[model samples]
Target: MAKKVLLRVYGMTCDDCVAHVKNGLEKIGKNVDVSLDGNAVLDIDNDFDPYKIPSLDVFNGRYKAQVKEIKDD
Candidate 1:
């Protein structure tokens, strides 16, 4: 079974910020699908947990993005 989720992120100030988050998620998910808005939706199969995945900032250790919300689809 696959899961879908919406992610609202803060610290995104422009298109590059959007791209940064999008790219980061894609890298983490590998084969999963990802799209970005003020938030992002991720569709995945398996035990991957969005909440457990470190924030973009945390992963990079630069504090560039913060997750604002996580919701099911």
Candidate 2:
């Protein structure tokens, strides 16, 4: 089973920011959903540590990502 992760992302102010976050997160998980309202959700493998998600530096350090919640899905 996969785990659902809710991330509180900061600095996402536009659609382009959402796209950048979604693309960056998709590299590490599945079903990536990013919003301009400062949130992201994805499905990751159970064995992976949700807290260890790397900083989303793909967009030139404009965004900060933190794990807000994690649960079974």
TM-scores for the candidates: 0.59, 0.86
Report the C-alpha lDDT of model 2 over 1-73, residue by residue, as the tens digit.
4899999888888898888889888877899898888888999998988887755455458778888999998
CA lDDT of every candidate: 0.54, 0.83
- Model 1 clash count equals 0
Q: Per-prediction count of colliding residue pairs?
A: 0, 0
Q: Give me the runs in candidate 1 sitting further than 4 Å from their true place.
A: 30-37, 54-73
Instruction: Summarize candidate 1's per-residue lDDT along 17-72 as a digit string, tens digits.
Output: 66666677775554433333455666644577666555544346432433445444
| lDDT at 25, model 2 | 88
lDDT of 1: 0.54
State the TM-score for model 2: 0.86
Highest TM-score scorer: 2
Worst 10 residues of 1 by lDDT: 58-67
Clashing pairs in 2: none
